[model samples]
Target: MIVCKFGGTSVADAAAISRVVEIITNKQSEQPVVIVSALGGATNLLLDIANKAAGGELLSALQLIEQLRDRHQREAQALLGGSTEAEELSLDISATFDELAHLAEAFRTLGYLTPRSLDAVAAIGELLSSQIVAAAFRHQGHPAVFVDARDVMRTNDFFTKAEPDTDEIRQLAQARLVPLVQQGKIPVMGGFVGATASRVTTTLGRGGSDYSASLIGAAIDATGIEIWTDVDGMLTADPRVIPAAQLIERISFDEAAELAAFGAKVLHPATIAPAVQRGIPVYVYNSRNPGGKGTMIAFDAPRLPVRAIAGKRATTMVKLRSSRMLLAPGFLRRVFEVFETHRTSVDVVTTSEVSVSVTLDDATNLASILQDLAAFGDVSVSPRAGLIAIVGAGISDGSLAIAQAIAALGPIPIHMASLSATGINFTLVIDDDQVIPAMQRLHATFFESAS
Candidate 1:
């Protein structure tokens, strides 16, 4: 059996869903388990409705809920075409929307949104889409079973960013999904939505559908996990940043993970972990161009000095300097402790005898963090920083790749640089405005020039 996940755009509307149905029909022989994201933009709309209601705009929230209800109903009608299944699905959609209205009323009464309440609202997108897709499959004469993800995807009550219980997931999946596959039935489940052990609704945060697919693939020990999205595959650089960015036919799991971590939006950062643990090959394909040979992420990709360049902006650099840190034994520990207390994650770190500099992708707790760090030294922040990373399996073998990267940068000032402990990722901190141009230049030097 294999696990196949389709992104939001691949199942955005009736036309998009038709394409997905066709793709799944062709893969039926493989005993594929399907995972789907919410219809495109549905999650965002749901979030908006939740916030509006919490902010005392119940009428507006209800109006948006009705709009969403209409969309799902329209899509289902187009797919099922006045069939009994269509009528049933319409009722289901209406019931779900009615529940949303009730939730909005509660939020308006409370005049605030808790994380758990927000997750309840956020999870509706996947729930509604999965149900509709499964019904459509049945209407098309395929024996597809709608499996509630919360039934198998057991997770902790982390609310907005719930973490899955892999052991529980594996056991539940074996008990729930294996039978359907054995009986020649396709199991369709919503991605990104899971439930706590006590049956409380929870979400795995944004970009979690891919993570869901990986977890399921690992649980079932499937032959492969396929991520179907709008793009062709992983590229040497983001195509939006460099039009000349070339497609990478294959990449190692480590290289792929590094790219995702640094800023490659093609795959979620956590998507590779479970697949790597299970030694499962992950495939990225364009749902629209089903016949195209998309990128394969495995352990056997060629070891090149640099396989891809990834960049992300909106970073902030925090620097602390103190003469007391020259040889302090626990100084570094205390410095990091402050950040830990504030629940802030530090990305890149560079240190000198008297100072430490780190980058933060999330600065929500910056003010509190800085106040805490003041005990250690002079705390300073440089906002609007950017990070560029060159990732490959062979980066740690020698210094040549690093030399090329530095040479490509030319006059662009670098605030800091750090090579990963594994030596596969070399990152540079620069001004946010330079991220795109630097990535373009780096791509040309490493990819285009050689081509």
Candidate 2:
């Protein structure tokens, strides 16, 4: 059996869902376990409704809720019209939205939204979309069973960014999902939504649908995992930035993971871990053009000096300068504990005898983080920085690739640069506006120049 995950665009509306049916129809012999994200832009809208309600814009939030309701109703009607399935699914969708409305009302009355409450609202998108997709499959004469992901995807109580419990997931999946597949039925579930041990709804953060697919794939010990998105495959650079960016036909798991971590939007950074552990090959394919030669991610891919360039904007660089860091045993540990406490992830780092500089992907708690860091040293913040990473397996073998990447940057001011401990990633901090142009230059130097 293989696990196939369809992204939002793959199941956005009637037409997209029909495309999904065709794709899965061809793969029926694979005993495909289908996972789907919410309809296009559904999750974001759901989040917006929650926030607006919390901010006391109850009327506006209700209007948005009705808009969402009509959209899902239209999808259901278009996909399952003139059948009993249409009525049943419409009621299911209505019930879910009604629950969402009540939650919005509660948030409005309370005048606040907690992470836990936000997750409760966010999970509704997948909850509603998965049901519609499953019903659409059934309407089209497929033996697709709608399985609530929360039933099998056990997670901790971390709320919005909850981590899955792999052992529990494996056990529950075997007991709940394996039997369905064994009975010649396809088990369909929503990605990115899970429940705590006590069954409280929670969500994995944004872009987590990919991570969800990986987790489910590992639990089932499936032969392979396929990620269906709008893109053909992973590219040498973000196509939006470099329109001439070429596809990377194949990438090693290590290289892919590095790229994902360094701001490659193709896959979530955590998406590779489970697949890597189980040695399951993962494929990224464009749902719109399933016949295209998409990228394969596995261990056997050849290592190269530079495989891709990835950049992330809105990075904040934090620098702490202190003489206590000179030969200090636990100074670094103390410094990082502040970030840990604030739950901010440090991306790239460079250190000197008296100073340490690190880039952060999240600055949600920047004020508190700086206050905590005052105990260690002078803390400085550089907001709206950009991070560029050159990822490959061979970069660590020598500095040649690093030298080339730096030279490719021409005169762009680099705030800080660090070679990762793993040696697979060389990252640079620069002005936010320089990310796209810098990525284009580096892509040209490595990928385009030879061609």
Candidate 3:
């Protein structure tokens, strides 16, 4: 069996849902298990409603909730032909909104929005969208089972970004999901939302849906996993940054993971970990243009000079200057403690005899991090920095590739550089304004062979 996951854009409207149905229908003989995200912007709308309600704007929140309800109802009516299935699904959607209303009322009474409450409110979008999509499939004469993931996917009580308990998840899937697949029933489940053993709603954080699909695929030991999304595939560079970016036809798991971790929009970086561990190949395809032969990620793909160029903007680099840090015991430990204290993650780091430079994505917390680091030495934080990574499998001896990349940059000042210990990636730090130019030049030099 194959696992198929559809992104928000693939089910954004009636037309998009129809396309998704077609893709599934074509692969129904394979007994595909489908995972879907919320319709485009639905999650944001739900969050807005929650915020307004928490701020004591009950009437405005109710109006927004009604608008959301109507949006789903209209889509169901238009796409499902006003059938009983559509009506039933609409009632369920309304009921979920009603629960949101009650939660809003409670928030007003409390006069504060807790993280737990916010996650509970945020998860309603995926819950409602999954119900509607499953109903639509049944309406179209397909035997689809809407599986509430909370029933099978168990996690720890880390409310906002809960980590999955793999052994429990595997046992649950074998006992619960395997039978439905064996009986030829299509199990449709919501992505990104799972529950604790106690049944409290929790999300897996941003890009959690992709991670969810990977977890399920790994649990089921499926033949392969397919991620259906907006793009054709993983591109040589983000198309938004470099219009000349070309899709990578095939990439190794390590390379793909690096690209995703750095800033590839196609797949969440963590999504590949489970699949890679299980040696399951993942196919990234375009839901809009289903016929396109998108990128394939596997363990044994042929190594290329450079598979992709990916980068993230608006990064901050913190530099610590102290002679006391030289060969000092617990110096690195103390530095990391500061980050931990402030709940920040260091993305990249470079150290010398008397100075250590670290890059972080959470610039909003830089002040707190700097304050914590001041106990050690003088700290300088630079904002509006960017990171670019060139990932591939055989980059261990990639002197030529690095030379080409530097040549392509011409005069762009590279503030920092680091090569991974595994040698799968070579990263460069540059000004935010030069990010796109760097990506385009690197892609043109190394990966534009296909284009």
Candidate 4:
């Protein structure tokens, strides 16, 4: 069996959904199990509706609901064309909208939106999109079975960012999805949405559909997992930053995970873990250009000096310095405890005997973190920082590769640089404005010159 996951853009509208249908039709021999995200921009619309309603703009929220209802109806009709299944889906879709209206009323009554309530509202898109995708596949004469993901992906009640119970998910997948596949049916599921053990609605965090795919792929012991998105595959650099960035043909699971964690958009950072546990190979492909050669991720891939360069903007850097840390044993823990208390995530770190510097993507808790750290040592905060990462199978251990990177980026001012603990990622913190030019230079040095 193989797991095929299509992203939002792959099922965005009638035309895109049709392309997905064609892809599935051709790949049915693989016993393909399909996973789909919300239609393009559907999740954003749902969240907007919920926020507007809670802010006492029920009228505007309802109006947005109307627009969403119309959009889904149009896409469904264009795909299924007045069939009985289409009619049934229309009712189902309408019922979900009704639930939203009721939820909006509850939000207004409660005067606050809890994480659980927000997840309840956010999950509607995946639910709706999966239903439509299944119906469209069946209309095309394929025996597609739509299974509500909640029934299979049992999770803790963390609500907005629920963690999946893998052991339970494995049991449920074998019992629920295996039977359908054995009976010669295509098992279709929505990604990124699950239910708690108690059956309360919950969501995996944003961009979690890829995580869902990897988990499901591992559970079913699939031979391979395919992530179908808009891009050709993982690229050497962000195309927006380096228009000439070339696609990487294959990557090790560790390298891919490092790139994803740093900022590659092709796959979610969590996507590689479960698949790695099962020794499953994951593939990334373009739904639009299905014939193109895409990237394959596995345990052993050919190592390169530097395979990819990934960067993210809007970062903040924190520096802590004090002589007290010179011979301290638990000083690092004490310093990090402030971040933990505020629930802030530190992205990169570089340290000396008496001073430590860290980069952050979540500045939401910056003020609190700084205030708490002030009690320990002198602290400096720099906003508008950015991170650029060069990923390879042995980037940190490869001194020549690191030398090449520094040589390519010598003109730019780098605030801090650190090699990851596992030695797969070499990250540099710089001014956000230098990201594009730095990426261009690195790509040219590593990829273009090689070509």
Candidate of highest TM-score: 2
Whose lDDT is higher: candidate 1's or candidate 3's?
1
Give per-residue CA lDDT, model 4, range 42-129, as digits (tens): 9999999889888988888899899998899999999999788888999998988988988888777776788988898888888889
Q: What is the per-residue lDDT of model 3 for residues 289-357, given as tens digits with 9 covering 90 to 100?
A: 999999999987787768788988989988999999998988888889888877787888999988899
Distance from true location, Cα of 278 in model 1, Å: 0.8
In angstroms, give how far residue 7 of model 3 lies from its true place: 0.2
Order of candidates by TM-score, top first?
2, 1, 4, 3
Q: Can you tell me which runs of candidate 4 are displaced by over 4 Å?
A: none
Count of clashing residue pairs in every prediction: 0, 0, 0, 0
- Using lDDT as the measure, what is the rank order of every candidate, best first? 1, 2, 4, 3
> How many clashing residue pairs are found in candidate 1?
0
Q: Regarding lDDT, does 2 or 3 come out ahead?
A: 2
Of 1 and 4, the candidate ranking higher by TM-score: 1
Q: Best by lDDT, which number?
A: 1
Model 1 C-alpha lDDT per residue in residues 1-451, reported as the tens digit of each score = 9999999999999999889889999999999999999999999999999999989999999999999999999999999999988998899999999999999999999999999999999999999899988988998899999999999999999898899999999999999998999999999999999999889999998989999999999999899999999989999989999999888999999999999989998899999999999999999999999999999999889889999999999999999999999989999999999988887889999999999999998999999998898988898999989999999889889999999999999989999999999899999999999999899889989988888
RMSD of 2: 1.0
What's the C-alpha lDDT at position 190 in model 1?
96
Worst 10 residues of 4 by lDDT: 390-399
TM-score of 4: 0.97
What's the distance in Å from true for residue 424, model 4? 2.3
Worst 10 residues of 1 by lDDT: 337-346
Q: State the local distance difference test value for candidate 1.
A: 0.94
